[model samples]
Target: MDAMEQVGARKVTFIDVLRALPKLAPDGLRMARGAVGLVTLKPTNKESIGHIFQRAAAKHPERPFLRFEDTEMSYGQANALVNQYASVYAAHGVGPGKTIAVMAGNRPETLLAALAGVKLGAAVGMINTNQRGDVLDHSVRLLDATVLVAGRDYREALNEVDTPTVLDLDTLADGATSDADPEVCATLPASTTAFYIFTSGTTGLPKASAMSHFRWLKSMSGIGGLGVRLRADDTLYCCLPLYHNNALTVSLSSVLSAGATLAIGRSFSASRFWDDVVRTRSTAFCYIGELCRYLLNQPPRPIEREHQVRVVVGNGLRPEIWAEFTERFGIDRIAEFYGASECNLAFINALNIDRTAGTCPLPFAVVEYDADTGKPLRHGDRLRKVKAGAVGLLLTKVTNRAPFDGYTDADASERKLVRGAFKADDCWFDTGDLVRMQGFKHVAFVDRLGDTFRWKGENVATTEVEGAIAEHPDVEQAVVYGVSVPGTDGKAGMAAVKLRDGTRFDGTVMGAHLANRLPSYAVPLFVRVINEVEQTSTFKSRKVDLRDEGYAAGVTDPMFVFTGGKYVTWYPDYPAEVAGGKIRA
Candidate 1:
């Protein structure tokens, strides 16, 4: 029996899980009692995602909405700040259809300004701070920003770039607000652009993916309400970057929609993570995989297991670590979800399943995935479907209700669309992720398709390879990717690892470990030892730069390459392999 069969039977299986969902009456009243009560059932009737602020203001105006350092803002005050910023934005000719760019870290004031911009029809283009040089220049340029608002610290980077209408957020925050009509504050339509969130650009340069108010509202209603079950008294721990959808749309909006409290942080601190949770009395938190690993690495403290945290929701938490994390941290719920900022549909952990990406109550497909190239195979007009309980490429149909609001660059946007999927003339958005259909509506996330490669006619999933490598005692973190060899069709695998402090890497031990678990081709041919891995704002490994500098000794930090069944210092002697000719590029 295969791994799927090794797993015991559950309550549901494959496509039947979709049909097995508890049916609601045609009138939809029954849904409100069970589903609605579980998740927030309210859909915003008021225009814009900021209707959340309106409702929160009305319901809990005196309640603390934002906490930053020693400063705090009530829901009423936050709404006022948003309105004030909207007025300032309108003064600067920013309204509906315009793009306002913001470059900063996570702060309540930054969020206030962003909410203010979105209150009007203007969209906020969230730029990552780590981005520099051409990529940084390209992001603001792509937004075609009417106004650029950034903190004082980023002025140097802003000076380096040429953009129209630059406003320092420090200057904006200095002025006091006068009474303003709450109703006069600009209202956004459902279809209006709310934010121009950039893609992570692991493959290439980041492109702006326009997020609509419609998508934002639906996410808050469907996933946030049903999956997370956020409550008004609950304080959300948002240490993730405001630029990330997980923090912005998922955490902040979800809280405001529920009249909940928000505990903002400048950035994630693994040491201070639990302290901050307890400090804020946070009921839930948002997380990425690395953050979880970092928390797990901390020496067990007495307070580590104690917190008000009942639920933790986010993406990229590995299935291997799922049970260990929840158990160690005393978390009651893990609402793992799978979706991309550039994609439309999302599969949320609705049933509170342990390791799976919950379920998709919408139309989706799990098609046969090509192991070598990692692309889905096309069968006539339709992509081949995966058998029950098999791993495949996850694709969501772009129906009327689940429209794909693609990126700003048309060519880049077109790359994610799978034409004629399921049926001729039908369209599906490629999630670019490998997922296992876990017997029911639940799906277990596998590795990313693009990161998987092949050697000797066998597929090697980078996540699997990395997970195996990470098991070594000396290894702290492992990032695996594929690199071209001079004379090979399939790319050879490579891994860069950060060793545990004060521990030296044992290449022999790593080699033997890999040999025991993975097929020969699945084993990494090259390894690079590093002080730390470079990650995006959301904790995803930045592989583009690493892939470019493949095994180049001095190009990156201290490095090592696997060879001769053991690891050795990477040197310039391997010219044939570096040229990509070995991989027959």
Candidate 2:
């Protein structure tokens, strides 16, 4: 019945992008010819990300904007809805500079609300709904959130949240009108904060990173618009939680700025993912490595090779699974990228490398990292740069072009930043990730510095080991960590597993699974079977305590080990190959 809905019903054409792009980038001369197709970006000093939408809406107002199951909205309808939400926020005492926390599952409404918040010059605090206990309390408090906007289903779950005010989305949607004609006081400026994304802290408490409108807009223009080559016809499939930067900043913001359609799933469902892709006729989708592996585990289906998807973009697509995933799913491009919610540097796999985080278009350095201590090696003032091909600490220079405003918690923010990092006069942000520079600004991800350890003279990647352990059909969740062994130089890799409901797990099957994928030292020496896997607010497994528990069987519950070909509880003294010295402490 609306103008946008009518447009959604029509077939999308490539010509639409050509027409809309000129408006999106007004100075057509500014963009080099064929840059869009060649996957190269043109440099420009843009004022605001809102300019992207303003240009897009003017050019393609009627193109499909969002799709949720059978429901859909065109660009025009979405613009109007965003405006209406902006008006509502202004009416409710939420204006420029204020922080509004959004707690919900992935949905079209979540993004709509975020845009509305942005329009009001209010920063959207992406709160992980799964957070409980102290983490939940810390996230809300850190953002200095005045209002908590959440979905109806989560109202009870968030009842414990002691924020000043809470607004249920279901109630707001039912009672409020999508009327945003009035001028909103929250017109965002370049310096305006757009997002307050929380990052897991090495010091226990999470830190809230401030994302400015200028940086956000630039990301859309430089990365999403130019790098990903998003178009009006593209329907971005997002199944990750809205709380994450991967889903919020990368996927939704990029597509919305390009005036493309967005198809939001409730959550990542491996069984229904490909089916949903076909049903939505999505041209592109976002993924994390774990989500991709989950989908790959599903019985290979004919429909996978028959989908309309041409490109899939996101961070965390592992190198080992890269070729198989893309080829099997018929995806032409996998824009595998590297970034953190709180760090300055970003690496886009623009070259489409199989196992690398690709190239850093920004200024960065790889410095020497201590494999034993898992810390960056520093001398009097300067940090040592690693050899060209060795795994080292990743650092990005803080400059005007790439400013690091850091987090709301000043102390936590200051901790990771090092003054005069590369030189006595320069400053940079320590990424905490260890990467092996492959030259040409490209870096191959080795592992998370602290999470990785040397076992039997070989460095073990916890993610790689966990991936292998997860393949067992009986395993529901597997968390791998390195535990210290007496008299050894480094740690021994151990696995904490949770079995699938009602399934009896066999250790031999798990051992075979690991033996097939990992090296002898990389295989988890100790397996602790439990009923549940403890995860962080964003579903990342918490490994500090697990590592502290070490291989002491009775220290944990339901511990199991491989003996003769079957799994049996080790109790106190587990079967040990202690004599071979295969594990280092």
Candidate 3:
């Protein structure tokens, strides 16, 4: 019916577009405004993020741009601050191809300083606030930063690292002047590096992913303008860390592109999330799957459904909880998406589809892969596409339109590239994710390729198992991974679990619950009751250490073994029994 809907129908089908017609007016208008905003905000030929910010600020000087807790900053005020910080950074030779390592929490200055670096055409290395010791040091060193800017709270952590020119954020803010925008902002190109966001580093040390201004602009236009469809009056609540691409690129870009307000939270708090959402008068919010689960687990609050939030955007909203989360919270639209920090491809739920990671313009493939070897399975020198609904390795073809900028570490970037994926001389960026193709270019996220392990000759998706385990009322959290059993051909399924407050783990109840939900071999063979599961800054479970610990008898954590009928306490002889083939999965 509408022009936008007519265009969209060509891609998603006319019938689905007809189904989406009623809701298209608002979304189409918002998207139209966003498209206009994108063209006006970003320079066509050569422009930096600072230029875009300046343009937006010039247009909506009085509009509220950033809200941190009780404090709010207008577009003009935020731009002034960024200008001052940019001046300081420029004085320190932090411009054009240089790197500035920034270590801070979700404070206003964190974003201000990062934007300042952007203004000066410098790449801002956003360090995870939760990282410490070796990982922290590695992140800083990997950036090869000319200057390390740190917040007061991270002083102790900075003291441990050997970085060049560590500057206090307070001093920089106090000394800088808000007179004018940096001259370098005009000279910078869209292809210039803007920021370096670290990958999850679940396997080893995190690699710094290079984000160019071109990619940021694309994210703003594609995801913000088209996918999120936020209006200038809308306010998006963001609680995730700024270091993550979800918060930095998705949430912030969406808000900025629409000239909307971004209400920032110090960090995710299950108890105070709704209260804060209400406080900010937020019309929308961003989420990961775990954040939604945490909110669902908390006692239903009066303010939960009382907020103005109509739209929820971001990735990792699982299919199992999709209906319940949307219905219970009274959320109107869920823009579930699939992307990675380093990868170029993205799939967004543009049509408000349930339980799907939407569709993308980019060319991608779901190819058969060997779970154990972590390699794509080939048929006569050609990679094979998996049947629809079957789990497979997801790869995005590398082309001029969707180029993989990759990581700062050349070796790490090289490792992710799959040459001759479909044809000779062809290259694809391996997403390292397992997803089930649902036809119509949509996909259902299955599990991280590394997280899925083989058990009883069957591939077990940890996310699927975790989803099942989480269904149990008493289970607060579950981290599933494969653990080696001596003399066993394949790894055994192990789960490190945390129970709800004041709830004790009942082996019989849990066993029965898991048995009802999962297949015989898919059920976790061992369960370790832990106080808390270790998580990365982005709330992704850290399974490498847990996998390394294995099922050692000397381990102090309370361990249990599923004896087919019920979970039983583990003893010293359990390993021997398993190795001797006495114990069976």
Number of the top lDDT candidate: 3
**Please, what is the TM-score per model?**
0.75, 0.73, 0.77
Task: Write down the worst ten-residue block by lDDT for model 1.
Answer: 576-585
Candidate 2, 575: how far from true, in Å?
Answer: 17
Q: Compared with the true structure, what per-residue lDDT tens digits does model 3 show for residues 1-585?
A: 743223221224447646866777767877776556445543235866788888899998999998888899999999998888888877777879899999888978888889999888899999877666555777888999988889999999778878878878887767776548887788887888899997643344567899988778778877888789888999999998898788889998888778899999998887899999999999999988667766776678789989999888988776667788899899989998888788886788878877777877778999999865578888879899986556789999987667788888788788888999878999999888888777678777766667656554344667767877888899899998888665443467899999999998899999888876565666888999999888888877877788888777567988999876779998777765655544554
Q: Pick out the ten consecutive residues of candidate 2 with the lowest summed lDDT.
A: 3-12
Residue 419 lDDT, candidate 1, scale 0-100: 86
Clashing pairs in 3: none
Instruction: After superposing candidate 3 on the true structure, give the runs of residues whose Cα lies further than 4 Å from its correct spot.
Output: 1-17, 32-44, 451-585
Give candidate 3's TM-score: 0.77
lDDT of 1 by residue, 302-375 (tens): 78877999888888776656778899989987878877777787778755656677777778888897765556
In model 2, the runs with Cα more than 4 Å from the true position are 1-51, 173-178, 181-187, 451-585
